[model samples]
Target: MAVTRQSVEQFDLDLSELHNDSTTVRFYGDYEEFEEPVQRRGKQTAAMRQGHSKDHRPDLKQLLYILTVSEDGGVPVYFTTDDGDKHDDQTHIPTWDLLKELTGRTDFLYIADCKLASSENLAHLHRQKGRFITILPKNRSEPRKMRQLLTDDPDCVSWKTLYEIRDEDGNLEHRFRTPREEEMTKDGYRLIWIHSLVKETTDEASRMKAIGKTTSELSRFRARLRSPRTLMRQRHRVQEEVEAILAKRPVGSFLSVEVIQEEEVTLKQATPGRRSKKTQYTKETKLRFDLSWKIDADALEVAKRSDGIFPLITNDSKLSAEDVLRAYKRQPIIEKRFSQLKTDSCVAPVYLKEVSRIESLLCVYFLALVIQTLIEREIRRAMDSSGIESVPLYPEGRACRRPTTRRLIDALSSLSHHRLQTDDGDTLSLYTQPTSLQSQLIKLMGLRPSSYGRKKN
Candidate 1:
C-alpha cells in the first residue's frame, strides 16, 4: 500500500476522487472442508466461503475481491481479498478508512455503486468528512417520491439544462438535465434527478419491443380461446397465465386484461356403435374462458412522462449535479481493473487447498495488476505527450486508440535470441531484429534499447 501511494504521488494521479468496487474470484477445488481464518502463529489467512459471485458461479467456492482504483488512469491503488460472504455494503467503511490513511486525507470524493448509498455507509462517511457520489437504488422511496411528484404535476419539478453533445452523425447524441433543487432528501443530502435524451430513446425502444412481444402472445392466446381444442376453462387459471406472460417483461403496466367466461353446451352419444333407436344422447355443459386486453393509454402516457430518468444522491454540495454525474461515470474504470485481474492476470481456478497459498496467490495477482496498469498507463501517457492518436496493434495494420497490455505483449512476443556454438569452442549470440512498431513502442515506454538485447558477461 505504501509503495502504491508513492507511485500515485510519482505519477501525479488525481487523488481527489477514487473509485471502489468488488468482484468475486471463484475456486474449483474440493474446499468443502477448510479451516476458518485464524490468528495461529501470528499469521492470518483469507477464508474461502460462498457468497454473491459476480461471475455467476455460486456452485464454486469464492473470495470477494475488492479493489480501489484512481480515476486518473484506472490504476489499482489497493486491493483486498475477503471472505466470500462479505456483503458489498460492509466493505465501504474499511476501504474508505484505508484510503484515508494512505492518501492522508478524508476529503477525496469516493464514488461507488448503490451499495454505498445505505444510511449507515453514507452517515459514516459524512461524519468523517468524507464525500461520496452514488446512485439511489430504485427500492428507495426517495426516487419513487420524485417520480410520483413529477408524474402528478409535471410543472412541480424544475430542471436545469446541463449540456448538449452531437454524435458522429451530427445528430444530438445526449442532452443532460437535472431537477433544480426545490427540496432536499430526508437525510439532508442533494438528490439530483437527471434526464437523458439518449436513455429516454433507448428505454422507449425497449418498452416497444417488450410490448410488441407480449401483445403478440396475448393475441395468439385470445385466438386459441375461441378454438374448440382449447382446454383453458377456469377464469382464474386463464388470468394467472396471462399475468405470468405479462410478468415476463416490464410491459405489464401498460396492459389491462379481462377474462371473459362463457358456457358451451354439447350433445354426445352415450351408446357407441349402435343404430338410431337404441342409442341414448347425453347433454354436457362446459365452461369456456376467453380474454380481452387493451393498452392503458393513460398509464402509458404517465410512464412515458418519466422515461429516461435516473436519480443520483451526493452529500458534496459544492459540486454541481453534472460534475457529480461525471465523477460517478468514472466508477466503471474500476471494473476495467477487475477485468484485467480476471483476464490478463488469470487470477482464478485456484489449484491450492491451503488458505495461506490462496492468500499469497491473491497478493501476487494484485502485484501483477499494478505492474500491468503501470505499463499501460505509461504507454498511453507517452502517446498523449507525443501527439499520437492511434497505433497499429491489430492485424493488417489496424489502428488502436487505447492499446491494451495483452496486445503490447503480443506485439513483442516474436522477438527472441538464439545461441550458436562455434567449432573453436566459443559461443555466438544472435538476436531477432525488432520490428519498426516494436522499436517505436519500446521508445515510447522509455526503456533502454539494450533492455531487449543479449547481456554481455
Candidate 2:
C-alpha cells in the first residue's frame, strides 16, 4: 500500500541491528485515540446509551483522548500508557517493564520522548539498563550537573571518542564522536541544549541541507515541541483569567513563569587526534576523500547553535551523539505503525463501544499490522528475478499507506466456500485454509482447480 512504504523507510530496519538477522525489535510509539460519536435513532433511551446529548437520536458522544504505545510491534504487545488521567484507582503500565517483557531478546534499545523522562525510568534504566535514549525533561535536576558544561568559559572544551567497529561486509567502520549543540523552540516553549554524536544522520546531500538551514524537516524539529495544543490550553485558561481581570481590575495579579534553559556541554575528548568530520562530496564525483582534516588537533567541540534546546539523556557508553540522535529520530517509524493501522487498516474509525471491545479490536489491529510488516519486507527482499521462481506472496505495493484489514487478512490468508451434494440433498459453505499463511501459504495454496465432477462420456 502507498501508506506502508511511504513513511516506514525511516524505521531503520537494516539487518545489522538485528541480533539473529530476524530478531524482534522494541522501539517507541506515539499516538492519540479519541472518542467516536454514537449514532442511533431518537429517544427510546437507546439514543442515550450511545452518548448522544440530545433527545433527538443523539449524534455525538463524550470524547476521551488516549495516547498509548505498543511493544514489539505485534499482537501480543500490551496497551501501554506514558501518562494519562485515571478514572479509577488503577496502576498504569510503565514503559520500562513493558519493553523488557515484549522483547524476549535483550539486545534492542528502547527510545521514547520526554514523558518517560523521569528519575524512575532513568534509575531503572541504569539497573536493567538495557539500551535507551530518552529526552531529558527540563524539570530534571540534570541541569545542575551539566551547568558547567554549557558556557563560554575558557575552561569549556569538547569531548570526543573514536571506536573501530566492522561493517556487515567485514569492512572497517570509520566512526568518530563530537558534541552537538542546538537551540529548540516551539509556539510558546524554548530549550537550550547539547548532545553527543558521531557520523552523519543521512547521506551527504541531507547533511548539507541541514547545515544550510534550508531543510523544513530540521526547521520543524526545532519548532515542534511547543505544539498548538499547548497554546490552546493556555488560551482557554487566559479567557477565564481575563474575565476575572475585567471583574476586578488589578485586585489580583497573575504572573506567567517562563522556564528558560541555558545548556552547554564541556566535552572532554577521550581520544587524541585531529578532527576531520568526513567530507560528503568527492571532487571527481566518483572518488571521495575525507575532505576536511582536523585543522586543529584540539578536541572536537560545538556550542549551542540556538538559544534554547532540550538535551537527549543517555547512559550508552557504546553509542555516540550521532547514534543517539539517529536512533531517536527513527522513532517516527513506530508512529508510522499507528498511522498505518488507523488509515490503511481502517481500525480507528470503528463502530464498537465498551472498553473491552475497543481493547479486543486493538489486539486484532496490531496482529494485522505485524503480518503486513513482515509480508511487506519479505516481498521487497525476495525479488521476483532472483533464482527463486515464485513471486512474493506479499505482492508489491499491496496497500497505499497500509493494507486495509480486509485486504491484509486476505493477503495473509484466504477462504473458500464449498458445497457437497449428499443423499440428504443439502449444501453448505465449507471454509478451507485456516492458518494457511505461514512461509508456505503461496507455495501450497496457489492456482488450484475447482472442479469436482468427471466427464459424462
Candidate 3:
C-alpha cells in the first residue's frame, strides 16, 4: 500500500482507469496446511487447492494471483492472493471494495474479463456507482439473441468503426466495429457489441480446423468399425466414443453424429476342426455399429453469424462506445503484468510449504513487479520526451520501439566490476566500460553515465 501510494503520487498516475486480471501460480508440494485457509497474524492465508488452472496443470495445487494495474504505464497498484478453488466472479466485489478503499473513489473504470460481467458483480458495482468494462461471456443469452437478430435481419446492426489498425502501406490489418445504437444487457447495463474482421477470419479458420480434425477422427473410427477384428460392436459404446470425440473439440455444435447399426451373419463349424461341406455349422447373427456425421448447416450458419461478435457491458452511460472499446482493449496490459510475474519474475514452482512464507514471497514478487514496471514506464517516458522512436535493444542490432524491463536488464547483465588488493595494502577497483547502447539505456533510466558502476549506499 505504501509503495503504491508513493508511486501514484510520484508519477501522478491516471487513476480514472484500472485494469484487473488474475493468473494461477502452481505449487509442486502437498501444501496440506493450505487445504483450508490458515490463520496467520489474524489474517487468513490463501489456500493452494486445485481449481481452474490457467497454467493447464490442474493436477498441481495453485493460488490465484489477482492483480490490478493503473492504465497509466500499466503499473500494478493493488494485488491479493486468493484461494485456488475460488471462482474469479466471487473475487470482484471484494477486489472492487479494496480498490475503492485504496483509491478512495468509486467512479474509476474497473475493467476485467467476462468473469466481471456476472450479474452479482456488475450489480454490486453499479449500485455503488462504480463504473466498469468487461466482455460478456458467450454463455450469456445476449450473444445468442444478438446472433439471432443478425441472422434474421443482417441489416439491423448499424456498425461504425470503433477501432482499426493499418500497416505502413495503409492496408487495413485489423478493424473493429460497433453498432451506432448501443444495446443494453438484460440487467440494464450498457452493452457495446464489437465486431473484429481479423477475429472473424480467425474464428472461421479455427472452426474449419476443428471440423477437419474431428471429421478425420470420425472417419478413422468408421474405418475401424469396418474392420473384421474391431471390438467396437455395442451401439451405446460407439455413441459414447463419438460423443467423447466431439466433446474433445469445440466442433460439436457444428457436427451431427449418427450411430448406424448393421446385422452380420457368420457360420461357425459345430466341431473345432476345419470347416467342411459334411460338417454341420451353426449360424450366428451379430450387430455392428458404424458412425456417420455431417456438418449441421443451420448450426454452422448461426455460428458464422456470431463469429466476430463480442459484447462489452458497462454501467457508465456517459462514455462513448469508442471510449468503452478503447478501455477494454487495454485489458491486455494487465495480462502483460501477469506474463512478467510468471516469466520475468519466476513466481511459480515455489518450494516453500508454509502458506505464510509463500504469501510473503508473493508480496516481495509484487514489489519487484512494481519497481520493474516503474523502470519500464520511465524509460518509455524518456524515449517519448526525447523523440527516440526505437532503441537497439534486440539482438543483431534490431530496432525495438518498446523495450521491456527484462530486455533492458539483459542489456546490462554483462557489465562487471573487479577489485584488487596489492601486497602494499593498496586497493583498486576496475569497472567494465558500458557500450554506447548501454550508456544510452542508462541515461534514459535517469542515471548518470559516470555513476554506472558506482556502488550503492
Candidate 4:
C-alpha cells in the first residue's frame, strides 16, 4: 500500500479509471500447515487450497493473486492474496471498497471480467454511487434473451459500426459494432452488447474443432464396443461413457447420443456332439449395446447466430457503448501485469510452505511489477517525446515499437565491468562498451551512457 501510494504521488498517475483482475499461482507439495489460514503478525495468512486452477493444474494447490492497475501506464496500484478456494465473484465487493479507500473516490470506473457482474457485487457498487463496467456472464438471462432474439430474427437488431482496427498494410484486422437500440439489464443497469467480426470467425472455428474432436472420440468408442474383450455391454454403461465424452467439450449441446441395445442368441448340442434330431439343444441369450450420435442442425444454427456477440453491463448510463468498450478493452492491461508477474518474475512454483513468507514474497513480486511498469512507461514516454516510432530491441536488429521490460533487461544483461590488480600494485578497470542499439535504449530510458558502470558515492 505504501509503495502504491508513493508511485501515484511520484508519477501523477490517473485515478479516474482502474482495471482489476486475478490469477492463480500454483504450489506443489503437501502444505498441511496451510490447510487452513495460519495467524502471523496478528493477521491470518491466505490458505493454499485447491480451487479452479487457471493454470489448469487442479491437482496442485494454489492461491489467488488479485491485482488492480491504473490505465495511465498499467502501473499496479493495489494487490492482495486470497484463499485458493475463494470464488472470483466473492472478492469484488471488498476489492472495490479498498479501491475506494485507496483512490479517495468512488467515481473511478472499475473494469473486470464477468465475475464483477454478479448482482450482489454490482448492487453494492451501485448503491455506493460507484461506476463499473464488466462482461456479463453467459449464464445470465440477458445474454440468453439477446441470443434468442437474434436466432428468431437475424435482422432484428440494428447494428452501428463503432470502430475498425487496421494493420500496418491497411488491411482490416477487426471490426466492432453495437445495437442502435439501448438495452438494459433486469436490474436496470445499462447493458451494451458488442459484436466483433474477428471474434465471430474465431468462435465458429473453435466450435467446429470441438465438434470434430467429439465426433472422432465417439467413433473410436463405437469401434471399441465391437471388441470381444470390451466390457461396455450394458446400455447404462454405454450411456455413461457417452456422457463423459460429451462433458469434455462444449459441443455437447449440439450433439445427441443414443444407446442401441440388441440381443444375441446361441444354440449348442447338450451332449457336446452335433446330432440333428436325437440330441437336446441348449439356448443362451446375451445383450449388447452400441452408441450412435448426430449433430443437431437447429441448435448449431442457433449458437452460430450468437457467435460474435457479448454483453457489457455498466451502471454509468452517461458513458456510450464505445466508451464502455474502449475502457473494457484496457482490461487486458491488468492481464499483462499478471503475465509479467507469473512469466517474467516467475512467481509460481513457490518453494516456501509458510503462508506468511509466501505472502511476503508476493509483496516483493508486486513491487517488482511496479518497477518494471515504471521503466516501461518512462521509455515509451521518452520515445513519444523524441518523435521516435521504434528502436532495435528485437533480435538481429528487428524494430520493436513497444518495448517490454524483459526485452530491456535482456538488452543490458551482457554488460559487465572487470577489475585487475597488476604485480606492481596498480589497479586497472575495464567496462564493456555499449553497442549503438544499447546506447540508444539507454538514452530512450533517460539514462546517461557514461554512468553505465560508475559507482555511486
Instruction: Write down the TM-score of every candidate.
Output: 0.87, 0.40, 0.94, 0.93
Q: What tens-digit string does per-residue lDDT give for candidate 3 at 1-457? A: 7888889999888888999988898999787867998789998888889999999999999999899999999999999999998899989999999999889899998999999988899889999999999999888999989988997877878889977899999999999999888878889988888999988999989999999999999999999999999898788888888988999899887888889899999988788887667899889999988877889888777678777888988888899888888888888998899888888988877878798899899999999999999999999999999999999889998999999999998999988878899999999998878888888999999887666675556
Question: Model 3, which residues run further than 4 Å from truth?
Answer: 274-277, 297-299, 453-457
Candidate 2 local accuracy as lDDT? 0.39
Model 4 residue runs over 4 Å out of place are 168-170, 266-281, 422-425, 453-457
Model 2 segments beyond 4 Å from truth?
A: 1-95, 102-107, 141-177, 180-310, 383-457
For candidate 1, write residues 396-419 as lDDT tens digits.
999999998899999999888888
The residue-by-residue lDDT of candidate 2 on 156-263, one tens digit each, is: 535344334578999865544334343222211123244322233333233343334422322342243234332322333534533443244221112222222222
* 238 Cα displacement, candidate 4 (Å): 1.1
**CA shift of 180, model 3, Å:** 2.2
Q: How far is candidate 2 from the true structure (C-alpha RMSD, Å)?
A: 22.1
Candidate 4 structure quality by residue, lDDT tens digits, 94-136? 9999999998999999999999988899999999999999999
Task: Candidate 1: list runs displaced more than 4 Å.
Answer: 28-30, 34-51, 57-61, 168-170, 212-235, 262-277, 285-292, 421-424, 453-457
TM-score of 3: 0.94
For candidate 2, give the lDDT of residue 46.
14
Sort by lDDT, top down from the best:
4, 3, 1, 2
Q: Judged by lDDT relative to the true structure, which candidate is superior, 2 or 3? A: 3
